[model samples]
Target: MNNKPYQRSELIYKDKIKKIKDSNIIIFGLGGVGSVAAESISRNFIKNLTIVDYDIYEVSNLNRQLYSNYDNIGKKKVDVLKENIKKHCKDTNIVARGEKVTDSNIEGFFNINYDYVIDAVDDVKAKLAIIKYCRDNNIPVVSCMGTGNRINPQMLTIDDIFKTFNCPLAKKMRKELKRLGILSLDTVFSKEKPVETVDKKLGSTSFVPGSAGLLLASYVINKIAFEE
Candidate 1:
């Protein structure tokens, strides 16, 4: 190997590595999808990353969450994710906030001008808040729709939100965006219908949310690295 770290990536990114490294990105959740997305982006050597999440891991989250484990149970997700990223990523600068995004705090939470934004939160209101703020400000953003109650990773795809179907979360977001007069949005969503289970609670696997997370990071990285 010609270098110790990022050698393979450096071969592919070449001169664009600096641009990718310099891009400022913020993710609004640290659940399964957001956790995987944050780690994936950090592994790519992206320098500036900010993650916002208020939830703490419980026994239920062990199913699909990237940072959830027996020892991390009851700990704040943002703190766990920040520590995880910092452990492996020396070049990346991470900001972790434990505050829950709300109508009252959305403005304050999004005060900074971000190059790109990733929406991975589970709350519909918070997701819409982030999308609205980014849209009104003309900031580039991509959102992760529903990954819950699904198992097939292959069904995950990225496209305009209006073009998506079969995913309930996408439908809700689409309707809300239309009502807001926001015509278009970019998002990672699943084409497969959510599997009906015996219990009413939503279910998930390691694959679906994780795959969407990978696609989310890929969307940002490709735009900054490959686009001419």
Candidate 2:
């Protein structure tokens, strides 16, 4: 019997694991950031997770998306991510919705009780909807802005979403949120120049997305386990 006592040792860090396990987290968009964030959070021993995404793994996604693989190219991003989580931690409670985040589904999608939300979608419209809903509900959320174009992952930083200037996506989000009377929120964004694609390829070659995703996950886990 492989009685390594994974469950018992987990109790040694019970207080910490309890804090994370008890919290409910929703991750939107299973793109570069979303995919990586999901993997990072799973390793942190979070008990409950809800992942939302309407995308499937593409050949291009193999570059940065954690769930992308040559064999799973056409698989839904959420499905693969959920499977990966289960493989790592079989006891984890995972709820996956293979649908896009939009105004129509936002309410029902986020209706479940969530302690925190991680915004990893690339679409500005979807990101705005998520931010607004979370802000209104006072649910803590960390959004990723513009991980598309950047080579240096070290330049990524977590800051007040409103304070993220010079980032093209952040600039747009700032204006939109300001118009909605929302002052600030948390975000992971890089100060490095946006990564450019020569032929408008489908995914990013830079390390920014993976780094930003890990950073976002780190912030959420820290807040849930220690700061809370």
Q: Which candidate gets the maximum lDDT versus the true structure?
A: 1
Error of 2 at 43 (Å): 1.5
Residue 72 of model 1 has an lDDT of 97
Q: Write the per-residue lDDT of candidate 1 for residues 1-228, one digit (tens) a residue.
A: 365357778888898887887778899998889999999988887768899998899999898899799999999999999988888887777889898887678878665667789999988898889899888888888999999889899988999999999888888998899998998899899999899987767888988898899999999888878776
C-alpha lDDT of candidate 1 relative to the true structure: 0.87
Expressed as tens digits, the lDDT of each residue in 13-97 for candidate 2 is: 5667678777788899888888888888877656688899998888877888886889999988888888888986777789999
Candidate 1 regions off by >4 Å? 1-4
Error of 1 at 81 (Å): 1.0
- Residue 13 accuracy (lDDT) in model 2: 58
> Candidate 2 clashing pairs?
149-194, 149-195, 150-195
Candidate 2 CA-lDDT value: 0.82
Question: lDDT of each prediction vs. the true structure?
Answer: 0.87, 0.82
RMSD of each: 1.5, 2.6
